[model samples]
Target chain A: MAETTAATKTVKFIISRQDTPESKPYTEEFEIPYRPNMNVISGLMEIQRNPLKADGTKTSPVCWDSNCLEEVCGACSMVINGKPRQACSALVDKLEQPIRLEPMRTFPVVRDLVINRERMFGALKKVKAWIPIDGTYDLGPGPRMAETKRQWAYELSKCMTCGVCLESCPNVNDRNSFIGPAAISQVRLFNAHPTGEMNKEERLEALMTDGGIEGCGNSQNCVRSCPKGIPLTTSIAAMNKDTTKHLFKKWLGM
Target chain B: MKGNSYFARKLHSLLGIIPLGGFIVVHGLANYQAFERGPEGFAKGVGLINGLPLLPLLEVVMIYLPLLFHGIYGLYVAYQSNSNTGRFKYGRNWAFTAQRITGVITFVFVFWHVYQTRLQVYMGKITHEELGSTMHHIASSPVFFALYVIGVLAAVFHFSNGLWAFLISWGITIGPKAQRVSSYICMGVFVIVSALFILSLVAFRGDEFNEVASAAIALLGNIG
Candidate 1:
């Protein structure tokens, strides 16, 4: 009798749905049979399988983008229960009743739960958030960094470009071209590397441009909302000081 | 994109904290003289500023130019950013929005304030010594009084909050603990400065200056 009762238990979800890139968004509710330790992605999958609303009407399968089922991928990030986080890690049992899911609207929504993260990528490109190393020849062991520096750099390197930080950021919305915190942290990571230090001035100059370090209003939501716990504000503050020095260097024609 | 250069962005933030912020602090203290030493003291403070060497040049270089650059560039920056405090109600997020809002209010208030007072003096309509009476007259109007109150409060908030932001952006307070401590200090500055402005307003309120002037005259008569 206990087993039967447990089997009959259900979990409900209200998902914000958009049919096309330009279409208006709407919400659809679904009720799925509860399973122990079920996550939001699994619940979404159940909806995809049935494609039915709570009132028993047939509907299109809910569309979302995901690759790695793990939280590391950051592909399944959405507004789960009004908090921007990964759906893969948001367990049904853990969230409040009638779980609500919506796309991170900081980026333009493509459809349903998928959003175009091109802005974030564009910022990464603008900031040159990478180490330019030639792969043509066999370069030997790279320059070494102190363990203390390397440890913190590793923490910053954990960023997955998930766009959660940007979503949580109030300054990174449609009107502002602020590059957001993730890319700023990425700049810090690469600039700290011994190989990447060669282009330190270049990276600093890139950050000194429009939509760069100056655009940050220092709201500090990015640090709290980052899934990997990257020290975003610290990186921003560091970059802020570096960019000012770069400005002075340019002024002195150094 | 027009004012979006590296130098432009950096200068905007720098001007906000430097000469512009310095001017605000000086101006607030000068106004506070009204409460501390009454009308004569406030006039003396204004007279000292006006009596400075190369007064026009000082105003143009330190006050006007920086104010123009900071104000225009600030408007451009504010236009570029959007506020999302409704969805993200974090304390910092709210501060972010409040900074912009207060900046805009301060801009408008500064324009009207300069027009009403300094412009009148510049136009040779009123002497600098009469500024106290002028202020009393302006405060006598309920609408202008309310506007000045809002404007002064907004300016105070903008300066205080901008100070905290300036510290972080300049990397003076990088760690979370340091940033939190700086926030408290900035808030204290805001409260103290705001109280000073309010006291100044109260000292200027509706014909109270007349009573103070009469009291001063009586004291002078006794001295004579």
Candidate 2:
């Protein structure tokens, strides 16, 4: 194959950058030398290589978060062109020009692209959204889930703590303390486990509290916005059933 | 079929009992009005509503008859839905179950509220002094207020939640994805409505209506 001399095009990015957590955000434009197959992160890297603004002023290299640049870690998730998504896979060729990148507004912006994901972590803790595995060494061959249940649960397990579901969610604003769909889906995931079932009643009871599963309005946005395509609303609906059953069981002294 | 056909009819059918549902709305509205009107205006509002021509007779029919019908029908529907939902494995199914369960709780609360307020009003057992009493009245007594608070909360869950599910049941919310978005929105609404009721109760309990209202005003004023 004859190697063709390829021309590089300039790709523009308008990023909302902040120096510190308390600093006011401002827009910075960059015209990165684009390669044919470059992704958003690669373009960002090009900017990082030469931290000069389009207006010809030297500035600090823009900061962002990224890991498992294959879009699995969800560390690089942001709002690209007004949509919450992973930046690692957001290709320069695919997006509209002057690609707008901002931190997902659902969480507090830690510096620039980094957000305080503590609310999601806190919600996971509140719901006990984990298998109660002890660190006394591996509990060797723990109780297994039914194949059918495992299939659904495997879907739930795909959540990467990416805040996309929460970002698209309307209920997760500062005024309210909704735990968001990811946590709710996690509740379903943990409660379905055999070991997780031991705390099933506890998990259900936790969800019964204010800002628990009852906080879900069934907007169904999380399922839609999920990049890994986790079935979030299904988990919510399943957890709802579990909580109700738990409530009845408690009421009946069963 | 998708836009406001089936569930709207169901809601309309439910709304037809508004004579009783009206009392629920009026009573809740009246109680909430205490936040704005204070004890005197609330009392006047109570008296004015009560003083409407043939209101006593209307109260007997509108209040009790619809109460009896709606209460029994709600129970019946709850029972039927419960049976129909036997051993369903879905979360939405559970949400529906919760809605019915909340409906039962609200029904019980409404029955008790009538016992304390509506029936008491009819029997002339409630003095004018007791009329405009705030959260304590809604909460009623300490023991009763606890139940009332939970019940009002249950009603909040039932109505707001049921309405959301009702949207789904009618197919207004299409697909699993959009349904999820709506569910999230509905959850947000649940938080908001729950907060409003919770704040209202807490304010009533603390006898801080003026303070709460002022805070709300300041908050709104700030927003503006």
Candidate 2: tens digits of C-alpha lDDT, residues A160-226: 9989988876556764456788887788788778888877877777776656664454445567679
Model 2 residue B184 distance off true place after TM-score fit, in angstroms: 19
| TM-score for all models, in order of appearance | 0.93, 0.57
What are the runs in model 2 whose C-alpha is more than 4 Å off? A1-8, A135-141, B1-224
* Top-scoring candidate (TM-score): 1
lDDT of model 1, residue B67: 87
Query: What class would a CAPRI assessor give candidate 1's docking?
Result: medium
Tell me the tens digit of each residue's lDDT in model 1 across B137-199. 777789888999999999999999999999987878888888999999999989988888878
Please, what are the lDDT tens digits per residue for candidate 1 over residues A76-188? Answer: 88998888999888888899979999999888899999988888788888878887877899888789899999999999989999999988887786677778898888889
List model 1's recovered fraction of native interface contacts, to 2 decimals.
0.71
RMSD (Cα, Å) of candidate 1? Answer: 3.5
